[model samples]
Target: MTKADLVENVYFRTGFSKKESAEIVETVFELIKQTLEAGDKIKIAGFGNFIVKQKATRRGRNPQTGEEIEISSRKILTFKPSQVLKNAINEGAN
Candidate 1:
């Protein structure tokens, strides 16, 4: 579901105003982004973990020109799902 869908569900469950729920969802997303930008890992039990990984500089070839270029190092965000979540998905296939 999208953020808006989440906000609507939360508002209905908590008896919160639509605006308040929207703000809460926005705040949570902002914090998640800020934490990731800071190179920290976030883990939620039964959900998944978000990690920032560093990639070393490497040489890459340009597809069009076939010219070799040095690719700069960068940080990439990755998610690893929890075992519980993985199992749940797998179980549904049976």
Candidate 2:
């Protein structure tokens, strides 16, 4: 679901004001971003872990012009689901 949907659900479940719910959601996102920027990881029980990974520079081709180009190295964020979450989804899909 979208961010707004999540905010609404939280507000209803906790009886929090819309403003407070929005702030809570935004704060969570900001903390996640800050942690990633600091090259750290976040793990939540029964959910997942957010990790930062380094990518090496590589050669790539320009799709349109068919020209070779050097792709610069960069850091990327990745998420690995917890076993509990994986099992929950798998059970729901059956």
Candidate 3:
């Protein structure tokens, strides 16, 4: 779901006004962004961990032109779900 959908869920569940819910959602997202940008990880219990990983420069090919190129190093964000979440998902598949 999109952010708007999440805001709506929070509004209904927390009995917060739409504006307040929106603010809360936005603030949470902003905080996550700030933390990741600062090279920190966020771990939410029963959910998952957000990690920032640095990738080294590598060689790649331009798909269209078949020309070789150097891919610059960069930082990427990744998520690893908690065991609780993994178990819950697996249970649902049964």
How many residue pairs clash in all the candidates, one count each? 0, 0, 0
After superposing candidate 3 on the true structure, give the runs of residues whose Cα lies further than 4 Å from its correct spot.
none
**What C-alpha lDDT values do all the predictions have?**
0.97, 0.96, 0.99
Worst 10 residues of 1 by lDDT: 1-10
- How many clashes would you count in candidate 2? 0
Candidate 1 C-alpha lDDT tens digits along 1-94: 9988999999999999999999999999999999999999999999999999999999999999999999999999999999999999999999
On residues 1-94, what C-alpha lDDT tens digit does candidate 2 reach at each position?
9999989998999999999999999999999899899999999999999999999999999999999999999998899999999999999999
Model 1 ranges off by over 4 Å: none
Q: What would the TM-score be for candidate 3 when compared with the true structure? A: 0.92
lDDT of 3 at 94: 100
Candidate of highest lDDT: 3
lDDT of 3 by residue, 22-67 (tens): 9999999999999999999999999999999999999999999999
TM-score of 2: 0.92
TM-score of each: 0.91, 0.92, 0.92
Rank list by lDDT? 3, 1, 2
Clashing pairs in 1: none
